[model samples]
Target: MVETSKVVVFQVGNEEYAIPIRFVISIEKVEGITPIPHLPDYMNGIFKVRGELIPVIDFERVLYQRPSNINELTKIIVIHTNELSLGVIVKDAKEIIDIPPEKIKQLGLIAYGKTSYFTGVANLDSRIITLIDPLKMVQSLDGIKQIQDFMAAEVNT
Candidate 1:
């Protein structure tokens, strides 16, 4: 038997990136966000969907060391991993494509960065897309609680 994966492709700036479709909840339009203090600039803040609050991360900042590029094509990709739901801002949400195991190749650190967000590169006939590691894409270290507290406080006020 052979293994294959369905990936959700998204654009960040000029580059196209993808993540396993299993981790994606949905792709949403960039309506607005509630800002939280004392967090890194990459921590774009939080947004609500069907009464559920999800943290939005500026993925471009985390990977490219710059803020996300907002335009007509921009979108927020809601992804879930390890029981946590996060919204990743991308220049655009593209499409879902299938790639077989053989088409995926490991990327060298020098190819991206020391702590690359991607695990492999998918060599598709039309375009090359970086397959992301959702587990490693965003760290749940600090400021998570800060956002939670801010939300809680708002409810009480």
Candidate 2:
């Protein structure tokens, strides 16, 4: 028996990226975010959702090394992995898709360094979506442990 992976697809720049639906908590509009200092530039800041503060990271900054082109269509994709809940800002939240195992291919070695989080690429006809492991993505970042610790303390308080 084979199982298909359900993913939430979202736009970042001209490319499309997907994260498994299991990690997604919610998709929210960009209402407001309070900027925090001394964090990485990609770390946008913290935002409130349901009385809980979630650290926001710009997907564009993480991918393209620039600020996200925030607009009315921009959204924050809340994802929880390894006990940490983070909000990633994206150009837009597209839709959920299911990719069969046969359609997924492992990325080449050239994409292994900075993009180690990319588990595979799914080709659904003409659409090519990069699949990312949210856990690995978060773990690959430097100083994310500090943010995780901060979040833990916030939760305890």
Candidate 3:
């Protein structure tokens, strides 16, 4: 029997994406996001949530090449990965659903090449939703240390 995993569904741009619910710690609104200089463009900034500072990533900008626009629909999805506790900013988040392993297909190299942020594709009700691996997404970025350094400098300045 194949194992099934529950995922939290969210939307970026016009596409629907899912992330394994295990890694998702929480979802909340962030009032203020402090910009960090010298960091990658996708790194939106840092926000203080419940007394903890967490880096926010612009998923739309990174995945869909869309401009980052924060509005009423904006939400911060907190993902706890091995190296970092990061927040991914999405336009909106949908309900969680259970996805069977059999429904997930290993995307071809070309498909993965185009959407490298997605780990696999899960088909549901004749629709395919991209599955995202938070750990890979968080660790694959090049300017994480720059973000940390900038955050530190902001603290000391």
Find the candidate with the highest lDDT and give its number: 2
TM-score of 2: 0.94
User: Every model's Cα RMSD, please?
Assistant: 3.2, 1.5, 2.7
lDDT of 3 by residue, 59-112 (tens): 887876676577888789999877778889998888899999889887775255
Pairs with steric clashes in candidate 3: none
The clash numbers for all candidates, in the given order, read 0, 0, 0
Q: Judged by lDDT relative to the true structure, which candidate is superior, 2 or 3? A: 2
Task: Name the weakest run of 10 consecutive residues (lDDT summed) in model 1.
Answer: 138-147
lDDT of 1 by residue, 44-115 (tens): 888887677888888788767899867788899999877367899999888998889999888886255545
Error of 1 at 66 (Å): 1.7
TM-score result, candidate 1: 0.83
Off by over 4 Å in 1: 110-116, 140-157
Candidate 2, superposed: residue stretches over 4 Å from native? none
Angstrom error at residue 64, model 2: 0.6
Winner on TM-score between 1 and 3 is 3
Minimum summed lDDT over a 10-residue window in model 2 is located at 107-116
- What value does the lDDT take at residue 36 in candidate 2? 82
* Clashing residue pairs found in predicted model 1: none
Report RMSD for candidate 1.
3.2
